[model samples]
Target: MDISLKNGYEELGVAWRRGCEFLGTDYAIMGGAMSWVSERHLVAAISNAGGFGVIACGAMTSDLLDAEITATRELTQKPFGVNLITMHPELDQLVNICLSHKVGHVVLAGGVPSKETIRRIKEGGAKAICFAPILALAKKLVRTGADALVIEGMEAGGHVGPVSTSVLAQEILPYITEVPVFVAGGIGRGEAISTYLRMGASGCQVGTRFVCAFESIAHPDFKKSFIRANARDAVTTVQVDPQFPVIPVRALNNEGGKKFIETQHNVIARYRAGEMDLATAQLEIEHFWAGALRRAVIDGDVEFGSVMAGQSVGMVKSEQSTADIIQELVAQAASAFSDHEVIRSNP
Candidate 1:
């Protein structure tokens, strides 16, 4: 569990491009944004450790989001980003909050970033980072003024695109013209990050791994659940069928999730009868999540909640500080770059 800097890949650093600069950092990693979990403490902690951290915007009012931004500024003078769900009605106000606080970057998640929205972000002096499901979408987002791209795969948590990270990365990387790509989904260990770095990704946006970090605010049960999870522990299921389109999310399968499927029918039936609202349905969906995470992370209910983890969870066996994790990941990347096997094997 110990990664001694002396015995590992020396001169570890990640080269990346964001906005107008090709920047290099001690580590090419980001603490992925998790709903109701990411805050100033966690974001700042990761950024201070030489990795990017994104604050999650699950259900924050303008005032509270502003406060969180201010607190993050107070915590670290280093760079960080704010993750905003595009479907949220108050998206503009939240974007402004980040601008006013001088947050250098804003990561738009859950949906596409519109041209107007990207224009507004530019006007506010913040760089836009948007997620794309495919190469076409990635190109479109770059045209819309996205400073960079977060290409997510089907293995991601919450609302996600149908494509797997492998397909998405392969389809998009070479085709996209300018903006740098940050791969999201199913990343859990130093070796995985190293693999992606070799795959033309600028860095890895890691949400689930950060959830298990000591500083995350998710119920202790949630963190502990991740502690014991292997790759097979997580699965994605359908809760509500959207008539427009459907996307699958990866999560831990448990009794609570099974109960949720049964409840989804009753709830959707009420919605169809015009007796329930979208907000109510959303609450019910998260209710299942809270209960499940409560069981897995809190009550030692590994078989109890819908724990969301990436496929690489099998590679993790112990928890370490954010700094230690970054160091190890970057060291691995450096080793991979220097290793002669790939060179010698090539004709």
Candidate 2:
């Protein structure tokens, strides 16, 4: 390790990092689970590199999730986690799969988690992590037995909340003391991570940066999109009609995104012509990108597929191993402390 890196870790007090103890990782950093991108290879790489990695179980069958967990185990003995959407039809079965694998942690994403779901995760002896978009939700998640909270802001990729990461951190970090709070959204470097930690965040959940990791399975074209993108290029989809609720999805602006707006317009026309009800129209709109992320991620269709990325995509200049990414972030974070002159000077 470089002397500056060692000095950086010392300044942050490695042992005192909030999420490190609970996550059982050397660093409190967590590789955000990206569907179609986060799999056994990437997840294990992150864990082996000393950061917690999470398998994204997006719309997978219980058997598939089981296979993924098992594959990850074969790759690394270090603790990792599985992120399951709460709305999954087989939610409980997925929880069981996690338990069967002796998974250390389970994260519930997409919506508010039910008590039964949280209970199942805990009862199975795995830590329950949930997203807290607001302060009230943060408190509720903690009370519902969630072992920790991930307060993600709207700057995140894919599905996102309306709040910005900085605002969310200020609102939720100050009052939430019962459990560790990890901040996410637009976090592309260690300086931002260190800033959040100083503001009472236990650690950070990062996604955009890892999307282009050498171990990530994202298509080469998708990686190129990230490499070429600037913060301004990542935009959210908008709902054409007010009657239909907009699901703000952050992704690289491309032909697919433009066509999605056209799709919404068509759906709205159907609703107006009395050919479709509001509910059906909304469903049609939502289904526009049913397999778009996979198309972009797996097939390298960057121009017409959902190239989901955060504002931080602008910062990813090249692909590196997961270990190198983690080390770079840690060194950057540690350097923040040194630059602040927080490190004690030798007398």
The backbone clash count of each candidate, in order, is 6, 0
TM accuracy, model 2: 0.96
User: All candidates' TM-scores?
Assistant: 0.83, 0.96
| Tens-digit per-residue lDDT, 232-313, candidate 2 | 8999998776788888999999999999989998889888999989889889898999999999999999889999999999
Q: Which candidate is the best by lDDT?
A: 2
Taking every candidate in turn, the Cα RMSD to the unseen true structure, in Å, is: 4.4, 2.0
lDDT of 1: 0.71
Q: Score each candidate by Cα lDDT.
A: 0.71, 0.91
Q: List candidate 2 segments past 4 Å from native.
A: 1-7, 14-16, 342-347
Error of 1 at 337 (Å): 1.7
Global lDDT for candidate 2?
A: 0.91
